[model samples]
Target: MSNASFWKGVLPAITTPFHADGSVDHAFLAKHAVQLVDAGSTAIVPLGSLGEAATLSFDEKVAIVATLVKAVGDRVPVVPGIAALSTEEAVKLAQAVKAAGAGGLMVLPVYVYTSDWHEAAAHARAVLGATDLPCILYNNPVAYRTDILPAQIAQLAGEFANLQAVKESSGEIRRFAAIKELLGDRLVLLVGMDDAIVEGLAMGAEGWIAGLVNAYPVESVQLFELARDGGYAASAELYNWFLPLLRLDTVPKFVQLIKLVQAKVGLGSETVRAPRLVVEGAERADALAIIDHAIATKKA
Candidate 1:
């Protein structure tokens, strides 16, 4: 796939829908996948951080990706997250995503033991070198704490043909400008921060890999469109309205909060795997209030 074709506009790192008993809810997952695509998402990302990919087994992740691929049926690209602790496991997951007929793979950095720039570059090359499908380098130093510098990214782009895009979540506005300058349109830079979408677009970001889109696809897509059309005033307005919920994702309990918001909107179940707890009492009520306020203030 070309750099422009993989993941443009609002591609939600979709959350996995689980059953009341905590099993993968394939039926509801498929339904929500269709709804997201139909609601104006340019692509669907399954088994991502927001999807709780860490807790799912290999078989479960494969099944979820296959189900999403089947549910979307080529209406939009399904990019499954290939997040693993090792380069070998990341390669295995990438191959599985490709074999499942997904359009591409979102490869995250190895999180267990952080590496320096050279090691990180080799790791990225090894993972992408394992698959023929297009790959999006997820530059989330906030979560991984290891930055993929502009020079390192340029080197990777020079080395791998399939490494065509990046999801910049470093929370540094200067980094976006630096990427645009260094890459010079050689790569597609998608903003991974919801609040930075408009600013990133103005700085030449191609699209967004939004997490809140799971709850508000319409608004997310609208923000993208407005940014694409240079309507920063309008885009900023919508973005500001969703800022409360977007800010909530920065919390350690964001994964649970996202699922809870999904449940509140009747989109998916709030069930999450163990080692992660569901929000309760004051926190839970506060999250729901944010969601409600977002819904009420949504543009027509």
Candidate 2:
């Protein structure tokens, strides 16, 4: 795929719906993908940090990608996140998802071990070389300990033909300008953090790999459009209204909290995979209050 054809606009990193038995809920997963696309999302991204990817097996991950590919068909791209405990496994996954009919890849730093630039770049290069699919290098140092800085991202972009975009999630506004200054539009920049959409766009971010979009895709897309198109008064009001809920994406429990929002809105359930559970007591109540407030007084 060409750079213009893929990796732009609102790409919601979707959550994996699970059955009561703790198995992958492929049915709802497929339904949710189409729903997001129908709601104005530019693409469907599966198996990211928000999707509880750490708990899924390799086969399950491939199946999730295939499910999304079949679910969305030609309407949108199914870009599965390439991640694993080992570089070899991550390479295998990149190739497998391509065979499973994924349109693109969201290349991530290897899981768990936070490596230096040498190791991180090598791992990313391995995955990038595994397939010719267009890729978006996901750089969220907050969640994924390995930080691929702007200089390193430029190096990878120069080396790989398929490295077409960078998902900037460092929460640093300066990184957007830093990457743009280095690459000069050679690579498209997408905002990976939900709360940073306006600021990222101000610094030349053309798209969004959003998290809160799992529950509020329309509002998320609206926020991006308002900010991107310079709708000052409307954008400010919407950002103020959406800020509290969008901040949920920056926290550690974002997965459970987003799923809770989906459940509250009748979109999906709160069932997550192992090593993470649904929020409860004070945490659950606090999250519910945020979601309710957004719904009750939503204008922008």
Candidate 3:
């Protein structure tokens, strides 16, 4: 409701809907964006991890961002992910996202198989420097192995006013608290881990960049609202109910699990790009059962 640059609330890293043939399903993706917005997400992030950013080509990513911007049509802010392996490419993608009418950018650390934090910070600054749009630093150490430490984030935030937010996915609540303590109200703190959203928000996180929100936007937003309203007990109840489904998004086969949950909800197909196989038979059934149980329990 507010036009804050990066306030705390629910922002779904929307799953990239794919056709059965493994091509970007633009039609389904557009519809899925609308579904997420209508279901209650304050923002939508296309081309995120759940969106299978690594599997998509540069042009495909651009097209997806464009489509989401057009589909969302001002319903919610669309912050596209820019996870290129190179700094130049990341900047180029950020420009593309800006041109596509994205509200902001979520940048993951370059996946160049290195542990250079300075290089990572430089790359992030380069990307943000090139774009006038606001940027959210994505700190997913498990995926990038380069944790954007709280001090580094404070430096980045101080250096770039447009470095408006940081999505902490380190699974460390203390790290979230540390960032809050270091930066205070200077930077927007968004929780990337679904299970930690409530705790993070309780500790001054303003929003959530969640993958599970792709399938359960209503429940996710409800949890966020409860937390925002100081209803920790109620928020915990919803969170615990959805914990199993949310945990599925953390597994090695996260893309597979997200798609499976989408398919189970009849929101989209369970298709992912190559090298990332779909969960089938037992795994697929298990994921679906978890999703079904969560939905049923929440409804009850």
- In order of appearance, the predictions have TM-scores of 0.96, 0.97, 0.95
lDDT of 3 by residue, 31-113 (tens): 88898888877788888888889888999998998898899958777898888878878888989878878888888888656
Q: State model 3's lDDT.
A: 0.82
Whole-model lDDT, candidate 1?
A: 0.83
Q: Is candidate 1 or candidate 3 better by TM-score?
A: 1
Better of 1 and 2 by TM-score: 2
Give lDDT tens digits, candidate 1, residues 211-246: 878877777787789878866886777778878988
- lDDT score, residue 192, model 3? 87
TM-score of candidate 1 relative to the true fold:
0.96
Best model per TM-score: 2
lDDT by residue (tens digit), candidate 2, 1-300: 578747778999999999999999999999988889988888888989999899999999999998999989589989999989999999999999999999899999888998989899889989999999899999989887888889999999999999999998888899999998999989999999888888888889899998888888788888988998984465998999999999999898999999988888889998988789889899988999999998899864
Clashes of each: 0, 0, 3
- After superposing candidate 2, which stretches have Cα over 4 Å from the reference? none
- How far out, in Å, is residue 123 in model 2? 0.6
Evaluate candidate 3 by giving its C-alpha RMSD to the native, one decimal: 1.9
Candidate 3 vs. true structure, TM-score? 0.95
In candidate 3, stretches whose alpha carbon ends up further than 4 angstroms from where it belongs are 1-5
